[model samples]
Target chain A: MKFRMNPVYKKELKISVRTVRMAMIILGYNAVLALIGLLSFYFTFNYSFNNNIDYSGILQIYLILAVIEFGLVLFVVPAFTASAISGEREKQTLEILLTTKLKPSQIIFGKLLSSISSTLLLVFSSLPILAIVFSIGGIRLFDLIQLMLFCVTTAIFVGSIGIFFSTCFKKTVPSTVFTYGSIILLVIGTLAIIAVSYMIGVRNYDNLYSASSTMIEYNPPGVGHAINLLLINPAVSLLALLSKQFGSPSYLSSLLSHYGKTNTVIFDHWYAISILIQMLLAVVLLCISVRTLDPLKNKK
Target chain B: MLEIQGLYKHYGKFTALNGLNLELKKGELFGFVGPNGAGKTTTMKIVSGLLNADAGDVFVDGINIRKDKKKLKEKIGYMPDFFGVYDNLKVVEYMEFYASIYGIEGKPAKKLIYELLELVNLSECAGNYVDGLSRGMKQRLCLARCLIHDPELLILDEPASGLDPRARFEMKEILRNLNHKGKTIIISSHILPELSQMCSTIGIIQKGTMVLKGTVEEIMQQMNVSNPLLIQVVEGQDKVISLLKRNPFVENIAIKGSNYSIGFKGNKVEEANLLHSLIENDIRISSFFRQEGTLESLFIQITKEEEGEKIEV
Candidate 1:
């Protein structure tokens, strides 16, 4: 094989190699949580619902504990990427690397991809725990695929935010703090938007709900519609999915068939719009980083 | 060859360089001397392309730096005033990184890296992390990295700043050897003595401009100091300055107890004639020679009374 001459990427990859050992610790935590998720679902396998232990309560207990695992994934993925650039500036190594013949795009991409590799590892480690949920019944293969898609899109969105903030600040402490703060706000912001929209819709159209009867639509505000929550916020999406499966009494058995149909448009809207917005923002933000890394040209 | 014509740089209202013109041929070491903020560093940065010049052209091997920076960059090596080493990178890797930047690789690259390590005298420390090396070693390694592309011109900014006497000597020797090999070198140094040893000519800058530019001897001629007469006698050598001060041409005289050096007021002939008269008084004048002007003395003489005004480099 012919040896290629590439200094900037070679050095970046070497530096990434040393720091990526720090990645194992991130994956290790996910592994531990996934094992716990597996055991919890296993113990709920043959449980009775004759007394007060209904199927809805059984799934609720497991879902709450499982949401915590996804939360850890979201929190650490940004943290891994937040310091990638600022750390180089702190050590005084970035300038020398910039002097090389390597283009600025190569440098920024190498850093972004390095962090993504670690994020991918943590995302995949949760698979074993998720498989146990399959045995609980009513889980679709399409839903599982949609959940993984949601994890990747959201991580990419958060990872790009982390990379951008890291370059925006000089010191690592301030950069990392703002990145974490932004991640928390992003999560809350999504939930808040849905809640506000639902309240307004209910008040405007009284037909949507009534005093003596229930509307056919079961709209859960602050969460995605059944399909959207499945694809975008898979945890909440899955909760809405499981809610339909185990609820209701013997007297009204036939009402359960129509649960998944309500508010399906929310997924249709967010899926296309979120992917487009996230991708456009990621490309634009990284272009700024390329300019940031240009030593002589960018500063003036 | 490196040629700079009509170079000018401004930071806000402050102009660092104005209409600066210089030419450096291969095998010549040009010393850049200046007081604080004299634009010596600014000019070097422009030539090296670390900082852009507001006006003018820098051509390395006849390729315009502005028009074709990558091509020009291939022929010029720049060592900034301050630099750093990466963590977990060894000396060999550091050299390899730069070598690869120049697009050299495989057996040829490994061979070049080995030779460069030896050239910088860091061969033994090839496996050691760069941060483990001393400041002087790092500076040498930086120079070595600059040479990885076999650049024709070298722009070194304060190459020996903050080094001990021994380390400074080592740096000086390394630079001298590179200059001896027909490399065009532009060196900015605060230590005038270092420049004195190796520089063929110098430009002294004061307050963002080059005030004095010439050979060492030419700058000495501009000084109003009297011609120095070195009186080596068979007998009483110390009495030369004392006896000469009373004469017409002498100013600021220093007596060496038994031997002395007096600043002569006029031309070489005038001082020699004065000494001739002293010999008639049986003072026994055997040998007399004019005191040579060192770069350090000339640097002080030009910049001292200028009152820190901005000058063009």
Candidate 2:
């Protein structure tokens, strides 16, 4: 059989593209990245020229732009997707769509794809600004591709979260609010858990040492398995990726060493592992949203 | 083209449908009638694959809903009582979107959309934004959207609930034309007269069950039995009254001056025989005919009886 575009995705894209909102979004998004990129480049070049320092510091501008773009993805993806399903309900169009031949999975996947596409549009439109770093010969094509892939995966992850909440709530306001809330938990909440566990481990080590009469071999307590929770945190994944690309593989390791021993293969491939974990989580969320969208599933 | 047997649906302690059995043949314009809170909409939703019945089976075009839902949806087109249109989408684009949902696209979709737009008298407004259209136009567009896939069964819930007389007339005409084209349709409405005129079969649902189902004429005949027979006599009023009292089908009689209203429960032949007997008794009859009963009256009577309340009719 020939391939066909998902009807919901096609329709959403058609409607979204026709609105001035999309143009404004693209314009505003690119303007911010360009403004920040130009300023950072000017300052870095000016500072290096004045102090007679190495021009290699200009590469920091690429890292700064990637971070800002990643932050935008986290912030804007949920807003794009949180209203997807709930807006249909609010407009009273869901019932009609539910009656069509389209499956619940198709509807959910289409909504998620449309949201990711919109976010990707913003990301791709900013590539020119990001390419300014390429002129300095510091960032490679592979690095840019990796960053783009990371942004796409992160958008899918956050967009799935928004779509899941959209199916759960009837109104877009609560869905958007809960999506951001969940993102915050994934970002800051994982770090907080690691901090709390490390503190407990250190406290136990201190009590054990204080009770000893003589000096014993030092075995500093570590956070143990709690470090694995960061696999689902996109911020940690970005930090790992950037740290490696910034020519300091030891930076992420030293950062992880503060909480625990970091000699595992998972830590070595933390970026890939985190992205995989987040994609898996996105699939699970998308499945749940599909189930929730199925009106017949509510049967007694 | 549609059959539902022993379908039951409940919302907590409230039962929306309880053992409701209904059937519609090919090309039937079935008018599903009931008072508020009846199972009309629920049954429509269940048949349209929008809701699952707790118990019983619904078969459309001989295909069971539970066994193959996708096939069932392909055979059904459902228009809800209330709907909304996308703001930025043109009428043609909206139709095309729904068409694509059924896997029809490109040239075929465009051709079907224009034809459907013409069918709904919306050909001129095809380029207009859907949200800019009036409510009647939107309803028409929705109806057109439902037909894009050419489903055999069309389930419309209150398709003309909030329309002006002209729009209602236009909708009725469109539905009539569709029915004449041999499409099986199940429609529910508060407008009984229109349903009576447009529908070939009528089903009156009460509570969760079908209290009555038959042709429009059959139901009208059934309700007409309870209608009062008016007798206007210029002479021998006492004799006419005595003769009516002696009849077995005469339930009650009310007199107003020269006009006598007799609640006669009888068929056409029985009614005619009684009129003949009265004429044979040397009664001067100026006029003698049964009062015409409306579908609204039958609906009220059936619903009232189900509620165990006394009905004045």
Candidate 3:
């Protein structure tokens, strides 16, 4: 089969590449990452040298860099993708595009791919700064590759959320606000729900214990199935990935175990499962965006 | 090459198109004219597949639009009334983008882009940024973009709405040349006189329906039936008035000096016969003809009559 670049993606790439804004973005992105990496390296070395400790503190720099990059992805991906469709509408070019032979799915995917490409550009350009840990002995090549893969998966997931809201709204501002709002809901709202459920479970267990006659075997309350809700949260996935890389998978498991005793396999593979779940949700959101982008879908 | 049957569209309680019907043959330069909110844009959008009619059948080249929209889209190129150009994109690149959408790319796409640019007389501005161009240039570039696919039918809504006279003239000439090249074009504009001059057939829509449709001369004649006839007599003005009053086709007559303006409800043959009768009676006539009706007048009369009917209702 012959391969053809989607026209929207091609045009967006052409235009974006020609603009100085892309250059500035890459420069600024790298500058910030390098600054943060240097600061973490300096502080870790200062603390270690004063105590006459080994250079194992370089690993902390890697963790700090990885976490900051993850935060950047979560914060920046939406700004790129949230205005993809609504910008076209605001510029009044969407109708002309609709009249063409391009399908709605093709357009949606084109916008998504373009936004993801921009994000990936930012990610890959800062690799040098991220690779500063390689000079030391802690982070391996496979781990770096895994981190990049995780970043990409998170980008696609958040980018899909941005595109979904873009298709739902006609203006860029509202689409962006709603996209950030949804991210906040996923990051914080899920945690809040689990917290509330855990508290309720604890209260119920206390009532049961107090109302029991004679003596009873003490069992702590857990959030039970509600802990599974965090599977859609990227932040938790990042923490799981970091904990595993830091050679302490128990940190994440213990943190999650406070809420509930989950299947050991799930905790053992939390990163993979969370990544899979987020990717599945991204697909669903992209499907909905494709449907929403269709001009004739609402016609009776 | 195009047919719309019982096309109905509504926006909440307001009906944009109410059973609107229209058809066009191959190589027709059809002019669509309507007041604001008359569903001109709605019909054009529906035909372009950018919009869906509430209920109707739109066929292009025997392909039902609802059943086979992709095929319909393949055969139609639509330029909306209001469109914007992408910043940082050159005119040639813009054309290339649209051309690629139709699956024309590489060498063939480049060649088509230049050809369309030349057609729209923007060949020299190919490398210039689209946003830097003037409004008329942007509009012409849009027209060029739509033609990149070489679609059989072009739906252009108000292509010359905001253009100056020189630009309007250039646009009309481009459309005329496109029509000459066997491309069926449906263009809507408020410039009625230009439409009358360029369109092989004109359709006037009002209140979600096509109130008038025909060739320029046919429409003028249709509306001129109610137009008065002016007759200037060199001699025997009273005799001319008396003869006009007795004629069944003449509803009323008004005299100002030697000229008589009569409300004449007669076809061309009857009008000729009336003139012949006056000449046969030895009433020396300097000139006798039906008042020359303009498309603007006919449009106003039709829309006004509809408005009056609505008021009465």
Best by DockQ: 2
* Model 1 per-residue lDDT at B14: 88
lDDT by residue for model 2 (A1-300), tens: 999999999998997887899999899988988888888778776767557756566687788889888998999889979999999999988988888988999999899899889889988888888899887787888888889999999999999999999999999999999999999999999989898988888899999888989989977688976688888999999999998787787767876877876558988888988899999999999999998899888544
Candidate 1: stretches off by over 4 Å: A1-9, A16-27, A46-74, A124-155, A190-269, B215-262, B265-283, B307-313
RMSD of 2: 2.3
Candidate 1: how close is chain B to the reference, as a TM-score?
A: 0.84
Q: Quick one: best TM-score, which candidate?
A: 2
| Per-residue C-alpha lDDT of model 2 across residues B142-181, encoded as one tens digit per residue | 8998898898999999999899989999999999999999
DockQ of 1: 0.35
DockQ preference between candidates 2 and 3, better one: 2
C-alpha positional error of residue B228 in candidate 2 after TM-score superposition, expressed in Å: 0.8
TM-score of chain A of each: 0.65, 0.94, 0.93
Candidate 2: TM-score of chain A is 0.94
Question: After superposing candidate 3, which stretches have Cα over 4 Å from the reference?
Answer: A46-51, A207-219, B307-313
Residue A291, model 1: Cα distance from true site in angstroms: 2.0
Q: Which ten residues in a row have the lowest lDDT in candidate 1 chain A?
A: A250-259
For each candidate, what is the lDDT?
0.67, 0.89, 0.88
* Of 2 and 3, the candidate ranking higher by lDDT: 2
What is the descending lDDT order? 2, 3, 1
